[model samples]
Target: MSWKDEIEQLRKRQALAKGMGGPEKLKRQREAGRLNVRERLDLLLDSGSFREVGSITGRAEYDDAGNLIDFTPANCLFGRGKIEGRTIAVVADDFTVRGGAADAAIIEKQIQAEKMAGELRLPLIRLIEGTGGGGSVKSILDMGATYIPFNPGWDQVVANLERVPVVSLLLGPVAGLGAARAVSSHYSVMVKGSSQMFIAGPPVVAGIGEQVTKEELGGADLQLAAGAVDDAYASEADAMAAAKWFLSYLPNSIHDLPERRETTESPGRRDPALGDIVPRDKRYAYDMHQILRSVTDEGSLFEMGRNFGQSVITAFARLDGWPVAVLASNPKVYGGGWTAEAAQKITRFVDLAETFRLPVVHLVDVPGFVIGTRAERAGTLRHGARALSAIYQASVPWCTIVIRKAFGVAGAAMMDHTRFRYRYAWPSGDWGSLPLEGGVEAAFKAALAGADDPDAMKDDLNRQMKSFSSPFKTAERFWAEEIINPAETREKLTEFANLAAPLREPRTKAPRYRP
Candidate 1:
């Protein structure tokens, strides 16, 4: 009465599952410069840490006498895994199996993965490839029926956004549901040359008179430029490494605050370069990235959305080893003006910080919302309003450093003035409703027009305005809490991190707006 026979059969089924659509399909997958699902999981997680769910839940056939004959394992591979010894939930599409189409997928595995990630409060990593469980004509023929479409476990997916960190990697051609899943993540990446994302593949698009290749339609660079995904990498391994690095900065879920790490860098260490990074001339754009890296712990800044939303830089960095959200204006792009894309990026980034209980440090150098017919058509002001709302709604500890120009509505958004203003200004801070350069003529139109030499009068008015616009004037009025030397930025920011660490409380946040 031993269960040895059944145990052997179970092992046999598990072995079949491991085969993963057999060697031929796997060979093709490798030839396409992609790793199989199992290989991806191995690379993504700590060695030998994957504990697979539904190992044998797939199409099976048996003899009339009830003896097993053949089995085809499900396309969806999901389980609990470890990244840097920390547990995470992973759901990867086995593209070798029917190209990971709906017919070959075991939907229960995906649903359970999402559910477990939320219920157990673990970060969810989706290695998306193929169509992301989207149906095909073959499925209808196999089932002998057509049905109205609906996502099976979408509630869990949406809930996980607030409950846990969701990272998706687009590793291959992804269409329909796959594309949606990648964009839904808190962070997403694509392998540069291999990955493509679209509403539908080229074959389907050709029917609509748009004959385009997959790469032409939705290449990594294209999607990154469109703000569809956070970043891209030259290789799948690099992308996976990036995902691990991103998770290292945050906790398993919103129910836990980000843990601090040990760093050799001194909190009071001052980089002299910070003092000269911002040129006195407003027309010149200094390297914001250099400033960001100098202010944070060595090699700790993990930037996202680099290609799209060029005017704003969003990243996760550590100050004295404390995880913090870093937002800065990229003066190199439109003089740090807020474009529609930049505003949208800010809104999403602020929501992420609020959801995860990450303290925010803003490096302000904004001019204003971009103006012109192109900006107007893009609804720049509307998106900027949403970004402002996100910033105001965030309850996290916030610190703002006015490095240079901070004018107009965009500048005012550097921090919520109504809150306890934990803010500072540099010697070069030039803030107001409008800058004096182009604004003098518009503001003092009659005064300049009545002058004997309008241009000279305008220059004289600018000089007077510049004197009033000095950061000293703002500091004297207590409009800005303090004006500190640029070299002291690291000390002040490290102090802010220490202050914010105690205030970070672990709890679920309101639903994040994903735009």
Candidate 2:
């Protein structure tokens, strides 16, 4: 009598929303080895932490009596959630609802999700599937008209990057708007066999006279190689876990500083094997990964974009439990020379770190920007200049460890000399405008040509250059910072973290993040 009938009607609608495209479609979704949107949310967020918004906003049908008859929930579902006990906003596309086509999308719900995250200063995670807000021809026929294409909530999506962290997961065949949203994040991940992202799926591509399968067109492997997404995993659960781990290194928003975790690992822990990690032969490649792991907290290294840039390594790791961005050169690839891809990767990673106010730690081993025909064609110099600009413009606490080879303009970029030079060098440091092997020919070309014994003359000139190449000579002249034993690397970096902690500040608004 006291409006009890209306309350019951609301409950009926809520129940209908939960049904989500009914039994058969859900069964097919499971058969395809994918979890429903709700299930994916549960896996991504902490247990009992989700508070769904707009649960009952969808299409409704009624009889002549105005009694409720049926309801179909909107495809865009979003709400507040927690990951590792930290609050975040999550938006997911329910593919079961009209294949997540535009006809089934609730535009307001998409807008609110991004707005809520930015206004509340919380991270946003998107679980993208199906077409998301992509248009469908059937919807046009239903309306008897068509309109200009526009993304309703795109401004909010772009603005959120400047305020908070945004992560996206591509969990199924994504096209059009879905694909755009997938890469429009600070970090993105895809499930290997379960996900594919493209501008348009195969059926549409065939209309353009090109036939391609989903995997071949935009598979995880191809996207990773193309640097469109940060990483990929074998399963949805793994991808969700990765998203959680990635947020652990950053703060809730750019207005706040990164959080530090308490750890029992000794800051002064030294690994004697580091002394010999680099081989005496300059041509030989050593395991940089091992050195990275050895110097940070026992198990806090999380690498991103591993497949895209083979010459450079970018990762987030902890030094004495304080989060820092780690950049290193891979001696195994192009002798750690920065290629165009590596240069681009550097710009992206450095921007990310600068946006979050994380301190920078660089392990130097670059010979220069990669040279020759391919490098020139790739515009390596332009990209390399952008990377150098990022390094100099960054205001974060900076530290550099000269591990082995640093040469040419790339070598000089190890640290910004204008700032406080928190720099150290290993006994193995070998840096110059150019390595002696190649420079000897250029510098002594005429001398060698006139020598009675050309080969012997070149060898004698190399020995003279080697005498000056010793790191101790640079240290004596106070040009290079202290040259320490490789075993002392961890202790030195841990000290840097402690020193850098006080210098941390919220990112300035001048340079907003670029996806």
As a TM-score, model 2 comes out at: 0.98
- TM-score, per-candidate, Cα-based: 0.98, 0.98
Residue pairs with backbone overlap in model 1: none
Q: After superposition on all CA atoms, what RMSD does each candidate show versus the true structure?
A: 1.1, 1.2
Model 2, 46-162: lDDT tens digits are 899999999899999999998878889999899998888899999999999989887998889989999999989999999999886646989888989988788888999899888
* Lowest lDDT block of 10, candidate 2: 506-515
| Residue ranges of candidate 2 with Cα displaced over 4 Å | 508-510
lDDT of 1 by residue, 324-417 (tens): 9999999999999999999999999999999889999999999999999999999999999999999999999999999999989999999888
Error of 1 at 42 (Å): 1.1
